[model samples]
Target: MTLASDDKVLILFRHAKAEQVYGKADHERSLTARGRRDAMAAGAWLHEHELGPELVLCSTAVRTRQTWEAAVDGGACGETVEFDDSIYSGGAQTVLQTVREAAGEAQVVMVVGHNPTMAALASGLSEGDGSSAAHECLAAGFPTSSIAVLRYAGPWSGLDIGTAALERCHVSRG
Candidate 1:
């Protein structure tokens, strides 16, 4: 996918790791301490680079929401944050649909969700040298608080092949 800031800026994030819950529902699992740290670090990295988004579209899952909340707190994004239930266990196609739905309202939009799907979306949208690295990273399974920035050059409503280009990717491990 060829990324152009014109289409939309898709910053895909894999939610931080969750603590093992012996009795809680899967959707309600919370983040681990290490996950919190990584989320903050991820947020700081975005803040330092001024990569704040115009809006945040995150899964309703506790871990995903917590990840975004922690990361976005260190800086100012000036964007609306909404919990989309569809994103809770969403795949690449579902994510793409959500992004397309939200594209018109914001210049930059961030999605916080799970792996495998996130990784799949990144691989599908990315091209060039880092594509392989990105793929490996995703396939290896993204650690908590990892972010991938993609540039799409078209209308958010009209996303398609070669529409997004990978700009940069960061992984927080500490």
Candidate 2:
């Protein structure tokens, strides 16, 4: 598909599953073995799809950080990721604002954060004009390590509810 110069790709990635441990703060939880493998698979998938992100906005939580690290180990070719505390608990609106702040010059941008917010943002921004199967998969659920690939045909600052199309969606499992 031919994309206009203003077109941009937004990849909303939910962090892989984290171990459920007692006495640990939610932000301190770490990824489980399965979570690590799944994260790696997600990285490989991103690499294979050529969704080369110029910037990654990730949550400051430990599991989220580990998820990015594992994805890199699996060949996600990104050098730097901006860890934002807002993404950890900031509502979807705050996360959107953060992403808009990154509207500099990148064609592809990825955000790795917790669920509910990720799922909500993905669904809210989608114009429902892309892959039907992907849409179905996303509607089913935004599981751990799942990615919602959205195409925004405008500047990041121009993004808003129902302004982007859900290009593709996948659940990465290793």
Candidate 3:
């Protein structure tokens, strides 16, 4: 289904900093104190910008879930938080597929997951319009609590590399 101009915002979020501990699976990692702060800051920015998400799709990983909880924290947003197991350790292409699958249900959808994938997905969908900061962040692997908004002009099923344009990119670290 082709997305309406008003129904085209796809916000990609990278999970916040994870507590350092060896031997534990990556999926079990939890956010650190600073990570919590950064997530909240990003959340504040989202709330301030009036970017209320209509749907939130997050990875089932511990860190991602924590980040979403702290960041959103009942802030200005619509209902529903769907946990997708595929995003736990998904790649850029997988992330894009996940977003495409849910394109028709909401005007704005937020996907909270891991880095490299999140960053790569942003870069892939972006038609080179991502800001220098965005490029830098994606190049460096999105840090804790980063958000990238991509505006797609076509149907989600047709979404491919460089099909969308990065409209906004923000990292709480800075």
- Most accurate candidate by lDDT: 2
Worst 10 residues of 1 by lDDT: 127-136
Question: 54-161, model 1: which lDDT tens digit per residue?
Answer: 788889999998888878665526378888988886788898898888757577888889877777787777644345565565556666678888777667887654
Q: Please give the distance, in angstroms, between residue 26's alpha carbon in candidate 3 and its true position after superposition.
A: 1.3
> Sort by lDDT, best first: what order?
2, 3, 1
Q: How well does candidate 2 score on lDDT at residue 143?
A: 97
TM-scores for all candidates: the values are: 0.87, 0.95, 0.88
Query: Model 1 TM-score?
Result: 0.87
Global CA lDDT of candidate 3, please? Answer: 0.78
Candidate 1 vs 2: which has more TM-score: 2
